[model samples]
Target: MLPEEGVNAVRVVVGMLVRGEYEELETLTEARRLTAAEIAAAVRRHGRDLISPPDEAFRELGGVAVPREQADERAFHVDFPLWTAQDGLSDLTLGLTVAEVMDGVWTVELDGVHAP
Candidate 1:
């Protein structure tokens, strides 16, 4: 099993599958003041799982993903296989941060998906 923090973070991403479908959180928030490019680079460096193939990442959980979009600078799409047992593979958009792209610090929030 993953550590408590990892499970919590993943849960947040899974929860996003509910209703907000088009809103993506900005990697650069006014408070943090980091640029998108910087954030992306940071994420790329530290959060390989953030950009890794969905199936590859999900394999740790005994599941697989049907990728609709290859991970890119902004977002990626995967039918998450284990989010809901009844739903099976549910379509989910993994929102990208500039840090995730450029390789930034590995935080659960920074490495997580937002609404997309």
Candidate 2:
């Protein structure tokens, strides 16, 4: 779950998760790409502790499949707004470890979300 991988997963899930709410055109513009620095900055600005070290936890989870037995559990949960230049805003739940393994078991819950 490097930033790229996490973002990719989020994009896929978000698209599937929120398909009818927004048009295809709107969704494309909402796919935001965030750098590691940008992620760190947001965490700092929100006064939230880094759930796991920057790049460390995600790097470990990348390509490592979680066991099916614990697929329902979530290893990490992120509470933050996902920023995009065009569509403006969104929120994301970046599932790490077990949650990622289940593929679609965990649902992203966003409040006052303008876009998926």
Candidate 3:
């Protein structure tokens, strides 16, 4: 099993993507900011409105994502495979890696999202 905190952070990030809440991603990132170019690139690569579940769906979508691999909580890198959308749960997985700013606190890094 993955750490709860890490899993939840991924959930929030994925929810923002699904809802097309691009601006909110900056807050969840390690640098605490994302330039327009970066966000634009992500949109171009991931596509806008890839998933559009209602706000409440965040709570119900994807059970905790188990990391295919992870470091100890105190380690800086925590990478895992996570489903990007509800419909793709059975097959699709996006590679996600976070940097632990502090113990047990994982923040998404730039280039953190990708195909596994």
How high is the CA lDDT of each candidate model? 0.33, 0.35, 0.49
- For TM-score, the strongest prediction is 3
Instruction: Give candidate 2 regions above 4 Å deviation.
Output: 1-4, 21-74, 80-87, 90-98, 102-116
Q: Sort every candidate by TM-score, greatest first.
A: 3, 1, 2
Better of 1 and 3 by lDDT: 3
Model 2: which residue pairs collide?
A: none
Which order, best to worst by lDDT? Answer: 3, 2, 1
Report the alpha-carbon TM-score of model 3 versus the true structure: 0.51
Q: Across residues 48-100, which tens digit of lDDT does each residue of candidate 2 receive?
A: 22222233323333433334456464433333333333333424333322234
TM-scores for candidates 1 onward, in order: 0.28, 0.26, 0.51
Local error of candidate 2 at residue 22 (angstroms): 11
Please report the candidate that would top lDDT against the real structure: 3
Candidate 3's clash total is 0
Residues 16-99 of candidate 1: C-alpha lDDT, one tens digit per residue = 323222123232233143344544443344322222224444444321222323263222223333232333333333432221
Error of 1 at 67 (Å): 23
